[model samples]
Target: MGLRSALFAAQYDAAMRHAEHEELSSRRAALLSGLRGIVYDVGAGTGANLPYLPPSCRVTAVEPDPNMRKRLLARVGPANAVRVVDASAEALPANDASVDAVVFTLVLCSVPDQAAALAEAKRVLKPDGKLLFLEHVRDAGAHAAFQDMLRPVWSFAAQGCQLNRNTVAAISAAGFTVDERENFTVGPAWLPVNPMVRGRATPGG
Candidate 1:
């Protein structure tokens, strides 16, 4: 892995472990509950969402960062059927319309091209498949301005994570019709990246 990837992997779990709280756990379980067949989890950092997946689902985790993959492998429980692939969101290693569902959690911001990644997610999904996502997004007013101001520095330190990405809008632009959505703020009010969106989207209108 490259320097940025190494750095991100080193600090990722420590920085994000708090996200495994009860509320987020409930949300994750709910998101993965309906999914079945083959599922590709993009940016599966440390395999945080693995436990929440339904037992009926088979998972393929795509993670480009090697260090993160190491931890992810460690987290894969004995019973859960999981395969790991070295891949990025912009380019997934799966056949067209082959996957039953695509899962993304706190991953859209760090991708170099959110739209391209979303397009790839669409490409790998079955016609009736869903894309489930949980992401931090740009808020309005002063919070948004704060995100803009700190994004340059933050991205450099946080492995290309943009603090101000309007991910929901980007998802829509990538040809996925958002069938369900929930927007809310997490963490402290003072944090610019507190605003988050979680939901499921389907390919085409």
Candidate 2:
């Protein structure tokens, strides 16, 4: 909410809207196919996932930026099925394990505290519920090193986005047993890390 954050917010929102859920069109269908009741979507900018979810499901979409929420309100109507709240990944304004499912697509890399965010996700998720995720993480080997080296500048420009976060390790450390993860280079190395990572995590019974 300070000067730097305010400026960061402006650019970050533009980057997000420019990308505009480009990665979700295909993966979202599969991820959202089995959902039933209450759902939480972390970093739910523009409420793009609003339509992919089931009709019966009630989405408590958490987004921190007021400006982004203002824009999101235009795209996603204020229906009973959707309730948008101003919140951040570090702290969720929800009861523990209250939601049936949680979706985090392309949000964690940009989160300031990935571990804390994941821990919060774990805390708020129901025992039987699933944490569905889709992230672009650091590649393995030399490319991974490049991701780390470039992160300083990348983060500055992208508003906290780190190019080098390992999706597998971070989620595991957060207590979310990974069900699946894949690595792919949609483009070149050096800049703009591209490793499409998708997986699921569940709380221990």
Candidate 3:
């Protein structure tokens, strides 16, 4: 990665540290606690979820951005049982029904194709595997219009992160049934990425 990407990676932790401490950290711990088996942390930016994952599970932390991957690799220790892979959400280098769970933490917003990405997640998971996600979705109220208006500029500046995506619908459309979920806001009301959801889903009939 060049100067811009390197700069983004370097600033990422500091930029999000406040929110992580105030809200996201607890959410991550709750969602990942006791999770076991082979898990894939898709879009694993800087390995933020590594500390929360249970030690028994083997984790594949997939990140395509070299700058982000560099920071992510630094967090994976020998005892962490985590491996970093250079891959995008649309394609995973795993076999069919090969993993126990797939995770998406603040990831759906930036993927080029939501349906394809979720489909890939489903494809690599076992028939009984679970899907865990923590994402900011399209606002359901009037702010949705505001989200749409700001999306173009936001996506450009934030590395393709869309501010108004109905990600739960995309998850369902991709053939997963959400088993449990909690909807809440992470920051002040004025923040565009407010109104997030953390949940668990399994393959649907």
Candidate 4:
């Protein structure tokens, strides 16, 4: 693995400490509560959602980055029903209609193909399975323009995390019916990744 990747993984939690402690952690807890059965935590970076998930349910934490996977492994304990797997978002390891739920927390922005990843989520999910998602979307008006301007540089530095992705629209375009959603911002107002959305979706008929 390259030094940059290793460095990013090593310092991820530390870099996110302020945001998590101040805003995102409580949202994550509320969003992940009561989830049951076989759930997939897509792009499970350092297992951030591990603590919030229901222990009664099995969790398949999918992370493609080896460096991130190493840290994620350290977070899993005997008490937590979590399994760390080496896999990307576009290509999952589960069988079709096998997973009870799929989770995406601040991950869609970095996936090579957001549509394909969401498609895979739909493919692996049972007919009634739900998709729980929390993502920072494109901002409004002038902020969106600024995000576009910052996209190239920010994405390069942040390991391909796009500065402005319309994740909620992408989720709907993937044929999932958004059942519930709430829009809010996190971190400082100057941060580019503001105007986030957390929601639940079901496979559309």
Candidate 5:
């Protein structure tokens, strides 16, 4: 990884530690509860979603940043059914139609090409497979304006994480049919990236 990627990975866990509170934990568990069979966890930073996953699922964690991968390896328990792949979201290592489900939690915002990443996710998923996502998106009104204004500086500081990504639209455009969705506000109201969406999408019609 480059210097900026290295620095982000090094401090990633610390930067996000406070956000790993009870509320988010509960939400993650709920988001992951239905997943089963072979799963690919894109952007599995520090393996935050590992514990929340069902034991029936075998997870392939795709993370490109070396520093984040180090912490991710440390977080994986000996008994956990997770394999780490050093790959970016736009180029997953999995084979076509191989995985039962693909998981994306706070990932789409940071990828250089959101459409390509989602396309890759769709490619690796079986026709009957599902996509599980928990993402913060561009909100409406004043908060949206704020996110637009702060995006340049925020993306620089937060390692390419855009504060104003319309992730749901991108997912739909990638050909997944959204089946269930829940939208809510998270963190303090003042935060630009506070509006979040958690949902499940299935491949094909």
Candidate 6:
């Protein structure tokens, strides 16, 4: 990697590592239940979700950054029974109709192409498969406008994490419908940015 790329990786690793454990843990708790068969976590940074997931469920965590993958390996233990792979959401390596479920936790905001990524998730899912996720999305009311206004600057500083991605719409556009979901705040009013949306995708491959 070039100097800038190395620096960015280092910075991202540090930033994620510095994140509040409670913030991540709470969301993981809500999304990890009822998972069956193959579980694919998009942007499985540092494998924080590995510990909470049931041992019975087979897991394959997809992450692109080598630095993050290294951290993930260190965090995941033999008891968790996880398979961490070098991958990303925009394009998955699994064969068609192979995976039973795809998990997305705070992943879509950073994807360069949201539609392509969701399409990939849809393509790999079994006919009876489901899409599970917990994300921070554009909220209702003035908060939504605030997200829109701050998205450009936020995306730049955060390395492509847009603050205003219409996550619900994107999923629908990708051909999967939202079966259930919830939204809430993850940050204070000033920054007012932290939020979580959890649900399953429905009525599509």
* TM per candidate: 0.93, 0.85, 0.96, 0.96, 0.94, 0.85
Judging by lDDT, tell me the better candidate of 2 and 3.
3
Weakest lDDT window of 10 consecutive positions for candidate 2: 182-191
lDDT by residue (tens digit), candidate 5, 1-205: 2888888888877777767673467788998997889999999988889999888888899888788898898889676768998999999988999999899999999999999999999999999998999999998899899999999999988888999999999899899999999987667877887888899999876
TM-score attained by model 5: 0.94
- TM-score of model 4 vs. true structure: 0.96
lDDT of each: 0.87, 0.76, 0.91, 0.91, 0.88, 0.77
Q: Superposing every Cα of model 1 onto the true structure, what RMSD results? A: 1.7
Worst 10 residues of 4 by lDDT: 74-83
Sorting all predicted structures by lDDT, with the top scorer first, yields: 4, 3, 5, 1, 6, 2
lDDT of 2 by residue, 70-164 (tens): 76676677554578889999899889988888889878988888889888888888888888887888787887877788889888776577788
Ranked by TM-score, the better of candidates 2 and 4 is 4
Error of 1 at 189 (Å): 2.1
Q: Mind giving the per-residue lDDT tens digits that candidate 6 earns over 74-113?
A: 8886655788888879889899989888988777888888
Q: What is the lDDT of residue 173 in candidate 4?
A: 96
Q: What is the lDDT of residue 160 in candidate 4?
A: 90
For model 1, state the Cα shift of residue 181 in Å.
Answer: 0.8
Model 4 agreement with the true structure over 48-92: per-residue lDDT tens digits? 998899877799999999999998988996656688889999999
Instruction: Give per-residue CA lDDT, model 1, range 47-85, as digits (tens).
Output: 878988877888899998788898898888665589988
Tens digits of per-residue lDDT, candidate 3, 1-205, equal 2776788789989999998999999999999998889999999999999989998898999999999998998889666668899999999989999999999999999989999999999999999999999999999678998899999988877778999999998999899999999999877876899789999999875
